[model samples]
Target: MFGKTPAKEFRFLRHIAFPLRIFLLLLLISLLLMAALGQYLSASFEDYLTNHVRDMAMHQAKIIASNDSLVEAVKNRDSQRLSEIVGKMATGSDFDYVVIGDRNSIRLYHPNPQQIGRPMQWTKPGALEKGESYFITGKGSIGLAMRAKTPIFDEQGKVIGVVSLGYLVSKIDSWRLDFLLPLVGVFVLILVILLLLSWFFAAHIRRQMLGMEPQQIAQVVRQQEALFGSVFEGLIAVDPDGVITAINRNARKMLGLSSPGRQWLAKPIAEVVHPASFFTEHIEQERRDVLCTFNGLNVIANRGVIWSGDELLGAIISFRSKDEISALNAQLTQVKQYVDSLRALRHEHLNWMSTLSGLLQMKEYDQVLAMVKGESQAQQDLIDFLRGFFDDRQVAGLLFGKWQRARELGLILNITPGSQLRHLPEGLDSTEFAAVVGNLLDNAFEACLNYPESDKSIELWLSDEGNEVIIEVADSGCGVPEALREVIFDQGVSTKTDAPGEHGIGLYLIASYVERCGGIITIEDNEPSGSLFTVFIPKVKIIYGSSSNDSDC
Candidate 1:
């Protein structure tokens, strides 16, 4: 009947708080177990009492049968003598009655005087004649009882009569009840204790779960999964033991792991990320914008700890590819360079306009025309030269802006003749190319600033010829010291003494880009006192229709 109830009837349980649900379920289970145990123990106790009573009755009957007086009394069929002996033995005993019977099954002695002369009721057929001693349960003169019968023998060892001792079934049942009451009390006490324990246990579990139900927790997990998957940055979460607890799709992809995140779950973070000290070291401290390599991919990573009150739970690391960061930096540098170039051009134009205005006011028409023609032709020629050789507009614009910037710094800038770069090498983009050329040129300009205006000069050479793009930049300035030359490309190494942190990263960044492209760069002392930096990047054959590009580099 309970099974036939509709499932919807119990659906309200889902709405209940987690602790109450757990307590109720535990209580129900405890009650069921206690009921089953109570039933079994009660039945067992009753059976034990019944067996004990039956055994007592049989023992008493045997003792009565062995008595020489009772045997002689039965042999003579003396009811008075049988009663006298049985009464003495029955005093201070547990049995309900003791009866003595003759060979004809006539009662010689009974607990009741009226039963003494009556034929014994419920006697087994031929039991007295066959001299059988046994126990039986049956309705007798008194009531239903467990009776043990023992045969009596004469001096010749022949069956004379029987002695029957009985205990009432109702009395045995009463004894069972007397024992069961205490047992029931113990069971009730145990059930009450268990219910209290269950309530505390359930409350503890609820607190551990942040007081949320199973359904609520499930919903939270789903939301977290969606959020993690949708994020652009790669994310990994590890437990306090350094085991991976969660990894997002972007994390797996960034780590170059093709297997699903579930396959990597519970694995040690060290196994997934090499040199995992970034995560393991100083775990309690939050780290941001840390440059580290994960599975051979350089990434800008940040790590933060997960906490529960005062306890440390674990840590989460979010990272993105360093190449992406470099790209963004490159774009921003290009924009700043353009802005500076425009500012310098504006200042230079104002000076030229001031000169032109002065000449026009003096009415020196010939000098004005000559100055205008010369300035326009010079600018036009440089623009045409850059457009003709450098096909990429970004690289061409970078060169033009640096040339203008060098002029504004009162330094002569020369682009070596026959320099040609038709197309950038494979794996190199225009923005990165611009960054490389711009940094080199900026360094040269800074170096030249140390010399007098008349003596300051910077020269740039670019050529994509015979399977390699070669670039050389030479500047007349205080050259790199012999001691610092080898470590010039290392981060935090620079000729400029001011700005300890800000001035050293440019060369390091250039070296990084160069190494990633499988290129070579070298620094040499230019004749007549200056530094010359040369770079060589090999070119690869391109197949236009292929999905994957093949590069020897």
Candidate 2:
């Protein structure tokens, strides 16, 4: 029942999630910045309050320090005078309480008339000994307050008594409320403005998205489908239940289906195309970009498991034809088998010839001569042709295989030997190296025989550089057109049209193999009027062997 449901859901989420997520992330960052700034400003304001109270205490101490008359009055326990002086000082200043303490640790004068004659039992012992200022915070008659002590001095600057000042801390709370309340209100206003901006952005994005109509959106989707459908690759989608929910034009054609809605679920997709088909598991497991083969067609299939968070949806699979890859593999396999057979034949034939030579050398010539005149004489040229066909032992058998194929195509072959050359590279794999040479020679012969000429000849030349082996093949037939020369090595581009079921992937395979074997190939215009293809294979270092010996056939 889930028909193309997950794809649409994924598309919807992709469009809507992007903008909303961005807004939330920005909002989070803004909130963190505002919180940090608020905490810092609050701490600075509290410190400012504490310092102001301390400054008032120091100012009171200095006033007493400058007045010798006030110190003399405090020393004489002049309560009326001290009280009057302290009351006047507290009048204009921010202090709410004041006290004068003498050297006997007794309160000589206090702003409160009732405590004037009382002992200051709360005075600390180290207050005078340490000669350091002290600050205290407590709840007083006037709510919360901060108190501090400062020593007063006589004419000689001796600490005779202390002037103590107390200021209402609650006043700091009132001051902070006066300034901070308005500031926080303004910040809240700014926060509202930012929230409005965020809302406007979200709305603007929504409005832009709403500009496109449903039909216009559908048109865009259809255009995408048409574009992807026209390509050579195939696209398929399967549901979690293993049902084929969608198949593109190429995919349908590739599967050779006539009807619509290919029901592949519960039916084992192998029934529709075959289980051995590549890309089936990608649909089952929801994995992508897997290389697979279908029937004889090589294809690269990409799998994407459709998932919504932890929820598993169906899978979408897309595939492109890899006929070139399959063709290359097949060609290499054929070359391997062909070369193996030739090598076996060479060993067998050498044994037979050696026996014949021994009999003739022993002067048992009558039997040997008769045998030579029989089948040996007729097959001598063919045997000699194959023996000298491939000079490089590692690749000789492969060349022999291509020779027969060339002759059958009515193309004349010419082979010339090189002087003893450097050994082939040690790292080159024997079978792969042989395949490269054989494939190139085969392609050259095919190109030469492309012309409808009664007479055609292909010439081969071999030589050696200091550390490189060179091969040149030239044909006396129609050469490749200059315009198509650059594209000849590309897969599926070929000049041959007569061969059935051939997709022109041969030269691509040849070039791929040549490069893999550490060699280079170049096709150029021949001297008279033909194509000359040259190959250079680097010579590998030899451990215990001499350079390759050459022979021409």
Candidate 3:
């Protein structure tokens, strides 16, 4: 676990570097190369100067040692003659000094006027060694100088004194500078060219990057808006600050927002959208998810953090209306209620039969007979009515459930019987079919119950017409207002004023289930009074056959 690994950074790093980075990298590399070249040129120039100085010393020493008169002149301490000799040699060669010194190791014949008898501790080695040249550097009374010395001998071959010559090294240093000047000049020129190249490439790279073109990005944004706007549910996006950044066309329509004159863009989210808890909840919990109804619109929102590298940029939230969620839940609850009621009724019926059996065992025959006759007559009438009204068990169950519910609500339900239709759809499930019947019954109950006791009335009629199943439920209650009829099936559109917590989803649930089951619904004013709602569903192809039982009585 502790072993070194390749950097995790590069794995996620795209080509994130900008043009400035390229320019700087190239400029730094060019500067380093120029510095290295300048160092190399300086070293070569120094070596040239050292070699030239050594060569010049050797050549001057040979020329002075070949003169025999120079040796005798050095032994006599003749300064005037040595001066003349050095002057003459200066004209023929580049040597600046020639001197002859006595055997006492003192200068005898010298170029300087004051040193004719000066001791020659600086050149005694060359004075004793014949034809040998010695090179030395020293600071004399005149200044700093480099000198060459050689011993001069008479015709008898005995060394008498020394011949000395000197040359300054300042000239050699000047020559070295002359050689390096062009190299330095070339290095500076190369740097300028590199700078220009870096700038040119940096500018070109900036143009090539897609981020440089804002118009293209704007076009993409427009396309995304167009695509999302056509969707059915309303969608909204917000930033970390709870500001509404974007809203699709559907969302704008649902919320009654207009973009033409209003400043919707970049507006504080709370101004356009209510229920700030959508964003705030996520921020505090690090889990930005909210599903709630706000200002009559259901919204499900999700918030997530936005990040670049190790930096936290902010947060983004995306949400849509929760209408579908509510619709599904309502439908399920209605079905569950129906099933529970059916089970309870079945259990109660069993208990009632057991009670009757105990009464019989106690020999209370007259009391039991009277109670049985009353129950039997009621049961027979209900069974007879349903047997003639609905042939499908799926539809029959819904009708029975609705009857039970209406009695509980203190409403009188009227039923009209019709011949059983033969064919039914194959794809229909029992739950969906039951919902179709249940919703109609619910609508009938709600509509009739809306009237005062003196005006309450309900009628349900069923029949088949040319490959279609038709049902009509009419109530002796004030009909739906004409203007609001078109919107009755919409979620949250309800006519009931007395029912608390009623979202007006009954008609919506009915319409939605019918559409899903390939059926349709319509509404109209009943003749003379009240409202009439009709349902038409395509006949299904059924292969099975069954016989109907007589009325329970």
Candidate 4:
């Protein structure tokens, strides 16, 4: 029987191989067991048959011999008469011989006619001399048989003759062939059942093992452990009791632990919790990322409650080092800002190309040249003006691109002349400034769409005179109301009812960039009737240089 056959208890059979191997094993065992059982049963049946036949033959012979006529015939040496009686009695049965003789143990009748009137050792000597009726096995001219001898008596009650009958042991053996066939059939059935059970259970075990052997599963487990340890983001878990339950290697490394993750096991996380109130505040705020200082290093972390069934089992925390995340975020923000700055410009470029194509079809070569020349000068003038404020070409490109798109949006976009942003410390590539400037410009352009084209204008002023890059973007559009100013830069706040998700990210990006750069941004009213977003980025001394990748375009 398979071990643990109860449902829901799964056991992988390590010894069971492929299906063919299981079949062969079951076949071999079944054959061996059936052969053993068959031998035992056959031997037992042979003994039983011998006893049964001997007892039946003895009983029948006694019934024939006790007759008065049988005694008289034997006493007269009446061979023919005795033969008639014996042959008549033996009819319609499997008896091999019926012999009648005086107590001298001589044969009177046998299937072999020549044995008549000859002496027979029908049974052992004691059966005849003592005139005792008994059974025994004998061998004579006939091969071997189980013979029964019964005594006959006249009215004086003295033995006058012995009647003997036998069934050949070989005949009994032949009859057992009928039993052997069905026995073999049953054994074959058992063998087949064993084979089927083997196949089914073997395949089931293989599936339970996830189509993998134990050694392969062990290898996978080890690989998974290594993967979890090598992951870059940190992970931590605490129980409902605030005990540290699970912490990965990355979590320990990110938290600047001198020991490994195990050293903190089962200990209260409160002892080393960053920002003492982080866990409480996170749970209260419904699980959001928080900035905290861990062991003197800044970290961004999130936490959640772990649950099992309906029970709150614990909390889980994931955290990582701030420097790497901040750097990655900056790169992503810069890319997004570049895309946003170009998106509007790209939209209007299609119109410009269409106009130029129409002009070319008309064969107005002079007009075409004049138009192209004016466009090139305008582009050059914007670039020259931005470079005059900040020598970095990346910043200059952003300002030029955003202004051109702002103009297309029908906003009178201009830069304040001689603003001291021209004296920005030599080292600023202005990626942060670019993010802040581009997103705000995009936001300002969108604000103006709510107003008529005549009321729209964006004036940007920059100065670096006070150890800061002071920037202001003034849009003559709907001014920020007092209530809205508090959360104007929250990621999903939008004044436009056009569509969701399309209009909110730009201002949020500007706010995030300003915060990470240790700069300040404020939204206030412009002079007449619009909004002013001002950014004051504290000056940081930085050196700038050109690289081989730098291009004039």
TM-score winner = 1
Instruction: Output the lDDT of residue 329, model 3.
Output: 72
- Which residue pairs clash within candidate 2? 270-274, 270-275, 288-303, 289-302, 289-303, 424-540, 425-540
* Residue-by-residue lDDT tens digits, candidate 2, 1-553: 4978888766764554544755665677667867787778878888987887678676776676457667888767787888777766667676677777776556777766777666654456677665667777776434567777777666766677776677777776888888788878877787777777877786676565555644566898799778757876777766665556666778766666654544443454455665533434444465455667665556777777877566666776777777545555656666665865566556656766997989978989888878778746645654565455444665654555555455555666666655232345545566555655665566666566666652577777765656777778787667778887888887767766666346455567656655554567888987666788887766753332332221110
Clashes of 1: 0
TM-score versus the correct structure, for each prediction: 0.83, 0.38, 0.46, 0.46
Give one digit per residue, the lDDT tens place, for model 4 in 284-403. Answer: 234657777776667787877766557677777777776566555645865776676588787767777887999999998899899889987987887777776676677778777778
Best by lDDT: 1
Give the C-alpha lDDT of model 3: 0.67
Which 10-residue window of candidate 2 scores lowest in summed lDDT?
544-553
Better of 2 and 4 by lDDT: 4
lDDT of 1 by residue, 406-465 (tens): 899888889999998998987788877777888888888888786553268888999999
Against the reference, the lDDT scores of all candidates come to 0.85, 0.65, 0.67, 0.72
Question: How well does candidate 2 score on lDDT at residue 360?
Answer: 78
- lDDT for model 4 comes to 0.72
lDDT-based ranking: 1, 4, 3, 2
C-alpha RMSD by candidate, in order: 5.0, 20.1, 15.5, 15.2
Which regions in candidate 4 have their CA more than 4 angstroms from the true location?
A: 1-226, 237-245, 249-259, 267-337, 340-350, 419-429, 489-505, 541-553
Which regions of candidate 1 fall more than 4 Å away from where they truly are? 1-7, 218-306, 312-335, 349-373, 541-553
Question: Each candidate: how many clashes?
Answer: 0, 7, 7, 2
So what's the TM-score on candidate 3? 0.46
User: In model 3, how large is the Cα lDDT of residue 342?
Assistant: 83
